[model samples]
Target: MLNLDVVWTSEFAANKWIMPLPADAIPTDKMIPATVNAATYRDTLVGAPYYTDGALFYFRSDLLKAAGIAARPKTWDEMKTACKAILALPAAAGMSCYAGQFDKNEALTVNFSEAVASAGGTVVDAEGKPTVNTPEAKKGLNLLVDGFKQGFFPSDAITYLEEQGRRAFQDGKLVFLRNWPFLHASLSATDGSSKVAGKFGITSIPGTDGPGVSTLGGRNLAISPFTANKATALEFIKFFTSEEQAKKRLALSSRAPAYASLYADPAVVAKRPFFPTLLTSLNNAQPRPKVVQYGATTKAIQEEAYAAITGKKDTDTALNDMQAKLTELSAK
Candidate 1:
């Protein structure tokens, strides 16, 4: 058996490196729908959905409360309004509005995907073709480009990876952050390492109209196509993704569970208060572009998205460039 990132499902299946799993043998009905989709390739289950991840919108609850904002923002405009109020406070003098993984790497691809998805546009069509020249797509990419242009995102955010953005939020230097679930544990720590400990809250990422869709992230387990012990591999995969083992993994490492019931479990909820919100995000999540040539596809995204957000190219020109390049990649 092989452990694989969700994005690798299509690649492995297309290359015949992994065998398609028997649908009747895996309890996919009990797993998060998005995760199950991630393990599928061309409508066939090629892997067992394992632990999963989705991004959360983290903000300073204390600042919002102090600014007299009682409700969390559910749209981009609402978030911007709330940021305006929060930043006007004497305590928030130097804080920027938001940050995400914006560097020119795989992280950039994920961010761009989320931005496009949140705006009700898709980076690639259901048939795995590029579709990024639409109005919705332009609106999505402009959120990042305009953020930099309007000073909503800090100047240095172009250099930020996940850890850098996490540190900024934990240090109370940001009013909001777009990041993954693993940040909850570190930000909740009572130690002095976290300046915003006990002062922050998490929710679904905001969108142009309402809640946003996150890029699905996690690992899947697949049987090697050449494996001799197919039955044993199937049995082990069942055990590994069982509800019992999932709970243990949750308690031990704080890995998000693939099963939906665990998100509502009292014990689990008590330990991780963000599970309910995270479950919503997961349900609404969309996997990053599922393509056989994922590496090249992501590189194309990062290059154009980086150029636009950094002002090296206008949003229109950059997306036009991205669309042509992605078209070439999809053709191959």
Candidate 2:
């Protein structure tokens, strides 16, 4: 819709697109600055955030306690060390250390972005310059590559998407799972289907040095630029982003609200006790590369990253190949 010029972008999308947006349509002061920043482009807002998503570190609290682990892992190294300890126990024989989306798909793109950002690198700068071959990015990508090689991550994870990894965690086959906020509700359902319910805890995704950055995901409301009902459209956008609606959603669903205040709302807090952790994750989140040909760029990264994870390409070779592919995509 943005490329086709059909939709009327909100201040959030306008900001993301680096173009001018109507001032009056900007999100209200109640919105979170980090979330507002995520939707803004080039200092202009073009979308109204509805819900926000970010990667959170989920762990089997029961398993961690049983293994005598004292606290959550704060870095990738710590997580791996903890995993090593957990796997050594007689009861955790069949479980793996960690899991995330490693499949050659768009989900892989998100995972790759988080890995790179955690190491303090960006795939593309604001000017659209490719930076996939940088040392920081290499360090980030190496974490994933090395994990697969050393068996810190399951060999079968190359085919796992969100649901696949979620199921693995839900089935109690994984010690840690890197995923979005929705997993909390699914795992905590009152139904008897979930084995990890009330047995897990959520925290910030383990970072390279500390807490890892997350790839931002969520829905934003935008209007059609060509729409005849601009007035009605803007009204709906305003309504959707209203504090009331946001609070309602926070109370009803696991969807994280765009309003900062909702994170502290007593009603919301009562239902989602992990809102504080999720908020921190969102604050550290970064969006995927903002390019018109994002799909192609993601595909290239996926192909190269998956190969590296699967040991088809060494780290340097994979980084070099990814840089070349991304550079080509940016030029178009």
Candidate 3:
């Protein structure tokens, strides 16, 4: 039986449960721990990275070839043109990538933040202030709205979850898709659930200025300062993060390791062909703002910014309100 209740650190800052983790057992980077963001870097090395994953662009190769383009776009402008060209085809239904309805709350914020990075922007200004209202963010949102208006983006995406959008691509309607690395297991499953498996190509989300970009936050295992099993927890971290054990854990679970090494395995590379491209993207990846209030700020952007783009609200009014909201949020 499980020793004690396991709650996401995001939900509870200090959890008390079970003994320390086993020597070879890996920690959950995305889910485990309590406030590793504030705990890991400042207080101590509370958790070590296991395997990690992030946003990867997946597309339909057959469609690209038919469109007279054989290579994946290495630039955002090219990506936009590719989207438009694909949308113009007789098979055009809509683009079903992460550009979905902006639902899935936290994930969407992470998604939007990633978009900002791709455009060579960031969530906070250099002085440690939120920059969601900056011109780059505006440019990024305008691109989303442009697609939404052109019918390349779905009207229902605002309501769809990541998995919901993932399954939708199987409808054979989407020309492209974006998701975390976990799809390697699901997409290749022989369960007969996916229609486009073995049919789509994967790449990085081409960057607007340089190449492409991916957000970087891997699952980490951290013991709550309140945990009674500190020894066991430390032991577990050592084992799980071990180069040997990480490879095994990754084979068994969807969670990725945080190390920069395990990515070199032939098996890992073969399965995730876009791995190399994603690594390059990772080099330029930026972490989310360190503030605890990041979660709330992102929510405001989704509900407000996405609404404006989806036609639920006017851009000028929505953006003005966003600026006011950020200003108010910062003052507090």
Using lDDT as the measure, the top candidate is 1
Which 10-residue window in model 3 sums to the lowest lDDT? 1-10
C-alpha lDDT of candidate 1 relative to the true structure = 0.93
Top candidate when judged by TM-score against the true structure = 1
Angstrom error of the Cα, residue 119, model 3: value is 1.8
Model 2, 161-276: lDDT tens digits are 99999899998899999988888878997698788898999999987899999888876666556667767877777777788888777656777887877777787788889998
- Residue-level lDDT of model 1, residues 51-111, one tens digit each, is 9999999999999999999999998889899999999999999999999999998889989
Number of colliding residue pairs in each model: 0, 21, 16
Q: Order of all candidates by TM-score, from best down to worst?
A: 1, 2, 3
Q: Which ranges in model 1 have alpha carbons more than 4 Å from their true place?
A: none
lDDT of each: 0.93, 0.80, 0.59
Q: 1 or 3: which has the higher TM-score?
A: 1
Residue 329 accuracy (lDDT) in model 3: 66
Candidate 3, TM-score vs. the true structure? 0.78
With candidate 2 superimposed using the best TM-score fit, by how many Å does residue 241's alpha carbon deviate from the native? 1.1
